[model samples]
Target: MKGGNMGNMMKQMQKMQKKMMAAQEELHEMSFESSAGGGMVTVVANGKKEITDVQIKEDVVDPDDVEMLQDLILTATNDVIKQIDDKTNETMGQFTQGMNMPGMF
Candidate 1:
């Protein structure tokens, strides 16, 4: 009886691991974009939380308002980071549902 139970538990664990790996792979190929200052600034980031691009509209640049431009960039970058975090959590949560095992992920 003990051996049978152990084998079953192992199989279940393996299956869950496989599902998690698949979900992670899918996330690696995913991406999200965010903008700030009325779309004057745009940021593109991948699911792995890597920034791919930062676009700033020429009209948003002012020689006398460097501080405002800096703030816009910061806002856009932070927005992109938040978006990436949300996507990662939502995607990983799908695989962790109903599983209470700590650190299993």
Candidate 2:
């Protein structure tokens, strides 16, 4: 009886794993955008935490202050990465709750 119960539990776990994979795949197609320096720089990233785009306003660039432009870009990129991390956690939390499966995520 114990063996039979274990088999059933394994099957249920497999089903949940499949569901989580599907959700992750769907998330890969979703995009999140973040900006910094008053929107002078903007970044777009996918759920996979891959950066897809970076946009810089021309007015933000000054010939004498290239470092300022670089700083803005860096800030925007970091902000986008943070947004991606937050979003991934929130999305995956739905499946992780109540399951203490170590290393599952």
Q: CA lDDT of each candidate?
A: 0.85, 0.85
Worst 10 residues of 2 by lDDT: 83-92
- Model 1, 1-105: lDDT tens per residue? 699999999999899889889888888778778888999999888878788999999999999999998998899889888877777779788877887968743
Model 1, runs deviating above 4 Å: 98-105
TM-scores for the candidates:
0.86, 0.85
**lDDT value, residue 48 of candidate 1:** 81
Runs of candidate 2 with Cα error greater than 4 angstroms are 101-104
Candidate 1 lDDT trough over 10 residues, lowest sum: 96-105
Q: How does candidate 2 fare on TM-score? A: 0.85
lDDT string, candidate 2, 1-105, tens digits: 699999999999899889888888988888988887899999898988889999989999899999998898888888878877777778788889997978755
